[model samples]
Target chain A: MEKKQRKQSPQRPAFLKVLQKSGLSFLAMAPLLLGVIGLVGLFQVLVTPKMLTSLFQGNSLLDTLIGTMSGAIAAGNPIVSYLIGGELLEQGISLYAVSAFILSWVTLGFIQLPAEVEVFGGRFTLYRNILSFVFTMLIAVLTTLSLQGLS
Target chain B: MKKQDKPFAFRGKYLLLTVLILYGVIFLVSSQSVQLALLKSGTILVKILPIFGVVILFTSLLNFFIRPKQIAKHLGQDSGTKGWLWALAAGVISHGPMYAWYSLLEDLRSHGMKDELIVVFFASRAIKIPLLPMMIGYFGLTFTILLSFYILLGALLQGLCMQLLQTKKM
Candidate 1:
């Protein structure tokens, strides 16, 4: 009976130990977390659509490139991406431009590089983002072409 | 054990200082944006913290209850197709900011998750099931479907590319 009781009690300490370690790890990571949040917050202010829309002038192809650059600078939730993508389309931005912006907005993370590097490593973060950035443009152009073809 | 050999990878102080300086410059240019930035920060923290806390707790519980060897066995190198599905599902369902998911991802990486799989998970996040209807409404069904397929294809390509390009340093 005492042996069973002892066994059950050990499980609780095991969980406690895990909790303690996680708490410490969270503390250790707090600085990085705060830094990411701060940077993203600052980006939120500076990247208002009014300020960003003007940068996307020129031909549709040029707009596509500019849109990719804008999206690569920061990221947001999918709903936000969709809403912005929709609004841009309504505002006379070509589907090519808006689509690239949304694509990179969801996929790329130049600003999140520090946090990603902390987790994955510098090479992976840097290279993967570059690939995602390139792919965003590729897919956006392909998407626009395909849609046009269908129409 | 290998994790200890390296110092903490994130130098948050430097990053924090960099952003603060940028904030100051932005403040000089537009005090309104600065105020907007702070307000945005507060709501973001409120919205993100709970989801972030829950993921951390889940990972902690997982770390305690499950051995690393078990994790490596299932989600590691040998996980294969099942692993891909697991990653894809997690990505599609994940919520909040991408950064909120970072710490949990780091935990998975330490437990021997492959780098390619990590890329798959990140890439797959572009697919949000809940938002599909809204997307279809805006872009039309055919365009939406094709785009979603492209996003998934892009994820697979990204993962495979990472696997091929990355050296032993990973």
Candidate 2:
């Protein structure tokens, strides 16, 4: 019994150490997390659906740019993007615009920029966002063309 | 693990203070908007809290059990195709909001995970299993398949781009 107890004692301290480290990490992240949530909330209230939809002017390049920009600003869940994309498609918006919107809506995040920068570093965050934004436009155009070609 | 290169506490505090000041200004302009914003923020906080708990617990356990060498073996600079495959699979399986995953990624980075793999993980998150049905309903089966393929491809391409760019910087 003494041997077993001695063997187990090391793990107990390790577990406690883990717990303490986790707690500290959580506390460290709390303020930044709260700030991100606050910004998302403000965005939700300030950016309306009509305001987003009105920006697309039907020119493929222009609409694609507008879609990507708007989606980046209003980043949220993929589900919400699908709903918004569907609505836009039904409203006669080109697939290029909707595709770009959906892609950037899920990929790019302007509101979460600070939190991402804090976690990943500014250069990394900037490069990733820029690359993702550019890819979103490319993917949007390609997806639309592929669909058109198939149909 | 290497210590964080930059201190985050001061920046986080400043961010929080700025947000609070913004709220105060918005409140003065329109109390109703402020109220709505607070409620929305509260809702988001509630939603993310549980995920945050899971992330912290997972990271702590990982820190305790997984050595930096093991992480390096699987996801390090020399981890190769296997590492890319692992990152792609992990990214596809990951759920919840993007912010919730940042802490875990940071933990992994400390344990020697590559930055390119991190980009792959983020890019692959575009494909959500739970939301696939809804996506198909909206965009149809063929489009969904094509987009999913493109997203996976894009994830790899992006990761490669990041690796190249970082290498160039070095």
Candidate 3:
């Protein structure tokens, strides 16, 4: 009976060891996964026409630029993307600017940058970001013109 | 003596079998859409098998050829802005979903990389070299040029802002 009990105990520890290693990997991936799911849920809730209309009531190019910047500031949550995309389209915001805004809102999260800084070093991180920003605007302008041609 | 190993292996197989059976039962209780999604994901993976293989092979190459320590040595504190520039170029050529690249970023960070460079890595996803031909075909050369310039410029601005505003955080 003692031998049998000893065997049973070893089984538990062996199983537990496997569980522990896999568990840590899962934990590391959990935050980003949850963030994505939460963003999707948020996208379904707040992406409405009226909200965007109120957000971008003005016509100035500068206003559009500001709008994009604000979008970046509020970044994360795809719901914002849908809402802003709709509003920008309705408000006659240039496709170039709107595209840039959408891209930045997702790709460039200024609010999240601090968190990123905590993970990546400030200098290398900053230089990489500047390059990304440049690319974002470039894509936006190009997308805008192409969209114009289609229309 | 070799035969004794069979009992231990059998027990391992039994445990795996038990877990799989339990998973199937739980999956049955889940929504039908969840099942459909799994099926759909499998189908998509099959369709993209070649791309998937190439990407996986590339990822392995990155792991083998570009050790994080090497990247660190070039982009580490003493290496300065020049190191950062090369880091961005390397980031551009790399592939996979954002989440997949996190570990690599973690590796770089541990090797003394800055956060601003990490942000640049995230930002450079906009420039897909493989898709450039398609984009040019659809958007025209002028629009493509302007868009590429804008993205690069915006990324540069973002990096500078973060560097100036939060250098010590990382």
User: Among all windows of ten consecutive residues in candidate 1 chain B, which has the lowest summed lDDT?
Assistant: B1-10
| Reference-based lDDT, residue A42, model 2 | 89
lDDT, candidates in the order shown = 0.78, 0.86, 0.52
Residue B67 lDDT in candidate 2: 68
Q: Residues A46-111, candidate 3, lDDT per residue (tens digit)?
A: 333345445664554554565556555543333445456655666676665666665666565553
List the per-model TM-score of the A chain.
0.80, 0.86, 0.59
* lDDT at residue A44 of model 1 (Cα atoms): 74
Best model number under DockQ: 2
- Cα deviation of B79, candidate 1, in Å: 2.0
Off by over 4 Å in 2: A1-13, B1-11
| Stronger candidate by DockQ (1 vs 3) | 1
Over 4 Å off, model 1: A1-13, A149-151, B1-11, B167-170
Candidates 1 and 2, the one with greater lDDT = 2
Q: What ordering of candidates by TM-score runs from best to worst?
A: 2, 1, 3
Residue pairs that clash (backbone atoms under 3 angstroms), model 2 = none
Give the Å shift of residue B167 in candidate 3: 5.3
lDDT string, candidate 1, B1-170, tens digits: 33452333434667777778888888899999888888877777788889877877887888887777777876798988888778877887887667777777888888888888888888888777888898898889978877777888888888878777875444
Task: Name the better of 1 and 2 by DockQ.
Answer: 2
